[model samples]
Target chain A: MEVAHADDVELAHRIAAGDEAAAEEVVRSLGREMFGFARRMLSDSGAAEDAMQETLLAILKGASKFDGRVPLRAWGFGILRHKITDTLRKRGREAVIGDVDPERDAFNAKGAWKHMNFAPWREDEETLQVVRDCMETLPLRQREALELFAVEGKDGVEAAALLGVTPVNLRQILHRGRSAVRKCADAKLGSDED
Target chain B: MDDRIRARCDCFYQVLSDYIDGELSEEEAGLVREHLLLCPPCLVYLEQFRIVHQACGKVESDDLPADFDVVMQGVMTAWRKDRCGDPEPGS
Candidate 1:
């Protein structure tokens, strides 16, 4: 999935010129990544599919206006961000405004490990199941941040750009996400020790 | 540890992902580096974080479904057809 910059730029040029072949190439190249992002953002398969379609349509309509300053994938992701936001807005849904509670403050002060024991994760089926279960329990925004930055290996700034959030906010999301995942891992791995 | 230094250590860990990814400003990075040198706990935390980070990547990227490419192709075909009917404006 290492798409070279030159290739993306050339494909983007063709797409801007209304080349159907290039459009197909663009979709083929970016579809899964975009779908994965949308799925995590919405946490609903149907909504993700709809959002992906809208994003693709926006790419088709807006291709000609692209200035080519940013990487094509980055621009495409930016378009997807807007499409997802619009879809969410239309559904009358809003992102949760997380509060900083005493528990969070304590966790922050004492270090997350103080509240939980850490054990090495095994590669057994049970271990994998626990990991999956923990991942599913994360809030949508935190999960999206983890998937985009950690799983997809996108840089924080690029991920922030794609999510349409400030880098500071993105950092907060990653921090919270990793902490939650660590807590889950700790709980699951520690159970075997008892 | 001084309370002030401990607070900075917590902030450093909170932003450790950013730090590892080179997202911080030079000044911020220098501050974190200084803190890491003096703080053994935060240093251990960073090491453990890296392990989890690498492990997650290994687990998630394994075993692509055989039909992944096919599924993408199907989606691409439909997407292309949706944009195909527009006559070149000058034509």
Candidate 2:
């Protein structure tokens, strides 16, 4: 989530200069996140591995074009995004599904939340565990959307860019993820209380 | 709740998320803020939603391969060989 812009620029310049150690350091720093990103985006672990390799190879091959203006992570993420997109395309549509009805709420037609009480609660270990569980219940695309936006702390535009969706589409997907998970958590917790 | 009052809170519930993310304009944000001053339930919902998001941010990362160096070396070696071939091809 945090990018050291100045350090990134320096790293990019060094990599562009064909500094092997600098390239290694770049891999050390950004490789894990890029791997995780690809893993989350691709359904196949093998495909994820291929995407990660392609991402690194592309970075090194294209390092000369690194002008240091963009943060190194941004450039790296862009490459990874492209690699993932190509993998998805070559493999033919890798399961982009979504489902959510915002109207399925406890709110009455009068616009009042009837029968649902969203009481303010502090964050506890139990709540965190439940949230984690709820995340597993989301559809693939919705879950990815939420992870990038909510978990990775990327803004709508950045998350959309990573997911290859429009910003408006990202918002809708995020909203669906949030509402679906929130409602599920409520139901789960409510049943537990019962 | 009265119809107008209920409708306003409904709007707040829907857009409170945009408010949380600072997506709402100054005017829309102001209206939501003003509404929150009176609606306790929405304040609760907002807090709950925020906590859910925060907990998600804290979700433990999946286990990555212990040695990324191996993978890096493989790609770097291939990359060098590929780059060694053929001139820059006049971009």
Candidate 3:
């Protein structure tokens, strides 16, 4: 379960009471996370900026409704996710569905591994860049799942709710996302070595 | 790897990501532990997966845009007007 930061709840109350400092606090605390995720989801700098502005405005308008139940950060992210979706919709960019799984060929019909070699990668900035590049290649939903879970440090249930999927479904999405990046990184690194 | 080891590796691969996140049940995780004891390749895979996980976690967040303060100032000004029942500027 995502632990709701008590201070965030308190800050929401203060913001509800028209506290400018509290509002600033929320902005300062969550702005980077929102911007980063938005940048990844909406590659266009202008779209990303629009999404962030809308998100901040929405947070201000909706702060009074904060129930102190959901984590404020997660709630803010939910709003940002909606804004990103709307931005994408306006741009007529919908997520492409039903991409073939690249990992299926790695195993046989009997579900046994093939002769592919899994070498340990050098842990450095260069290899990390490879992994990040592979991550960028993921579908929007999959990359968002990976970012929410692996990057933003959100727990399974929180991430699932934010992604609007069941926990089991979220896990499947996450597994596919991880496998895609891992295999993609492997291929890139192998080519680099060659 | 023999057929038995090969079979274990296959099963372990299925739950490998879950195992890394400690999302597996105790029994499931224990099974993975036992498999790692017998399988060197699986262990290497696990190590590499951890590296990927770490790299993802270490990803830097994008910096705030330079005009963010100006944008935020407008938002706050509007918010203040709303709170004070003030009319829009130049209205």
Candidate 4:
């Protein structure tokens, strides 16, 4: 994400002033993205919506708390992340840390390919969509890591923190997740005769 | 490939994810680039890595409620209520 500028700062000020229009604007602008984030974390539409409502409520109530130390959007995600954590905790669920070993999956002790059987993926939109589909086919543990780090562009440290792993462990999870999804997508596309 | 080179390739390929994300040190990335020039498999892997990066960097989001505005209005009402006893905001 690019750095936000003065406009967002102004928006924060307006919202803090208790302007209803400003509150609505913030909800409309970030609500969808936050919804997407909530959905990814919870994977339940009703729970996601509940979390989103709570996030929006937090934004409105906490607008005065935004000190402008970070980009407004970044601060917004921080709140959303907290809301997601609260929702997960209330449900008695924890974010599972994936232990996929890319090195073991892709290479033998000799550093060569092992158990790989697929053609290269075509660089088209359709193939990319298939890549996303293959991403969904992965176990939720790996999928969540890829979704947070790669797809959502979250900070590795934050992602690792959410999953309760160190940064190095998170990178290994991302590598193994990417390798599995890439291979699965390649095979699915190569066999499609399209 | 010699044992030393092969060992280096293995090490380099293992963390290519970090390399692709620009997480590696300059010297580590430089070493990987040098290995890429000598290894066809690693080169292909790099290309696929590009594809994965491109594909993952953008994704479509689903699962938004149809009545988002309505729900948000309800949330705003409660927010307005909490800050003050005023039933209507901007009063």
Candidate 5:
């Protein structure tokens, strides 16, 4: 069953008060989503696993300090984001924003016609598989915004909240992410005009 | 709106993901909506955006492995036990 909206915050409060069951529930509720975010951010399964552990640890340790200004999930995601940044910094690598204009033009030129052609092939399972494969080609922030906004049902504001960016910035990332994925999907779907 | 604004209506098509998702403010949404009503290219872009949104919506969050939950449960359990010094598992 899906977790109720208030239960997440309630569980965080209880876990802060040393309730083991609540802590377990919090982990179970947010684990997969958090894992996916970490994996996408780190791009290394082992590092992602470590990041997940660190995120949970931070939640456990920092739960008492939560200001309750945002949803528990968002707050948890905030903690996870910090953990990711810290991990990356420790590894001597920082998040780099790719050149948006050139990348955009390249994908737009290649993808304009390709996506138009691939649109009709959507019913094919292979085409959807190709889309999924193409998703991995996007940069971390773009992929996160796309995954959260499109796949996980978070609105732009919520996604931006999770990523620590403004909603406008999140929208820009989503635009670029979709364009890149569409381009790659087009390439994978082949050039046959249909 | 001037010819420049009219010509750039297609540019807003790229941002329809934001608009349809309610990311735009009331004023901004009004501007885009007006453009879409007047521009065929923007309308086509909106349709494509909807299609992509629908296609993306079909991807299940169940893609995560079942074992992930089990592993997380174990990890949380261990963390709790460590915190509370519990001897019995899940007790």
Candidate 6:
């Protein structure tokens, strides 16, 4: 297998050799990020913990067979993504309460901006809170897209694959999510520009 | 915005993420690039998009649950038992 990171490949080998230290290293390196990702992906604390545990177990079990086509971190994320999806499935679909289509509201039927004007963002703690609140309110798919692309730092192709959407679809989701958050923040925080 | 500028901005909006992601073809990206130079509204939107992107990245991470280590230990113990028929390596 074509390993992306040499140290990761070494770690894989150590893990395959039943090195507990290597396993602990993996946990230390990836645990917080995994928990954080799960927390954001699942609203319930117990569900997030369950997903994180499942992902870590899956990683330890699969380490012997690690092919290293991607970095160890990305591999762990893929497993975590699967766990999150499974958890979401078991939870069934969340309620569609007050689901407004921002795209329709923002763009005209002909695709021109209906509201072209925007106040420059006033970056502050309040702005961050507004963005977080807006993100939480977004539809699951759009939130996941933003999480993977913006927060998790996955590229378009990788995020698209994780979300099981085409690149075009991923972009659409990201754009709409961004627009909604921007609109929300602008409304709440007003213009930094005087 | 003028009708012509609005028309161009419409095209740009559809591909905003793609443009930011560098996924657009060079020709398409160049067109958007040229449009941003003359279009204040679209330029503001682009900058705003970037700000939001940065803000998203700044969302604080919550600490792991208190029982995280215990749960992980439980998993590793179970896995060890499954692999070696014992909870501990030798026992």
Tens-digit per-residue lDDT, A69-185, candidate 4 = 666666776777777767776777555544655446566776666644435656788887787777656655576577667544645775665555677877878888888776777
Q: Which ten residues in a row have the lowest lDDT in candidate 2 chain B?
A: B1-10
* DockQ computed for model 6 against the true two-chain complex using alpha carbons: 0.47
Every model's DockQ: 0.23, 0.38, 0.43, 0.42, 0.23, 0.47
Which lDDT value does model 4 have at A77? 69
Give the Cα error of residue A135 in candidate 1, in Å: 2.4
lDDT of 6 by residue, B1-91 (tens): 2233335667777677777778777777777888888777788888878777876665365766788788778777766765678898865
Candidate ranking (DockQ, best to worst):
6, 3, 4, 2, 5, 1
Model 3: runs farther than 4 Å from truth?
Answer: A1-22, A43-47, A62-73, A86-93, A97-102, A151-154, B1-6, B37-40, B59-71, B81-91
Q: Work out the TM-score per prediction.
A: 0.62, 0.65, 0.75, 0.65, 0.67, 0.68
CAPRI class of candidate 3: acceptable
Best by lDDT: 3
**How close to the true structure is residue A155 of candidate 1, measured as C-alpha lDDT?**
62
lDDT of 4 by residue, B1-91 (tens): 2234334556766767877898766777777777777776777777777777666665474745898777877777878888786757668
Model 3 chain B TM at 0.62
DockQ-derived CAPRI band for the predicted complex in model 5: acceptable
lDDT of 6 at B48: 76
lDDT of every predicted structure (CA atoms): 0.63, 0.69, 0.74, 0.71, 0.64, 0.73
Clash count list over all predictions = 0, 0, 0, 0, 0, 0
Q: What local lDDT does model 2 show for residue A70?
A: 56
lDDT of 6 by residue, A44-115 (tens): 788877777777778887887777777787788888877777777677855232234465556677665678
Q: What CA RMSD would you report for each candidate?
A: 6.8, 7.1, 4.9, 6.0, 6.5, 5.5
Put down candidate 5 lDDT per residue, A108-144, tens digits, no spaces: 5322311322243445667666666666565656766
Query: What TM-score does chain B alone reach in each candidate, compared with the true chain B?
Result: 0.56, 0.59, 0.62, 0.59, 0.54, 0.63
Badly placed stretches (over 4 Å) of model 4 are A1-32, A39-50, A58-95, A102-105, A115-118, A139-141, A150-155, A161-164, B1-9, B59-71, B81-87
Chain A TM-score for each of the predictions: 0.65, 0.60, 0.73, 0.62, 0.67, 0.68
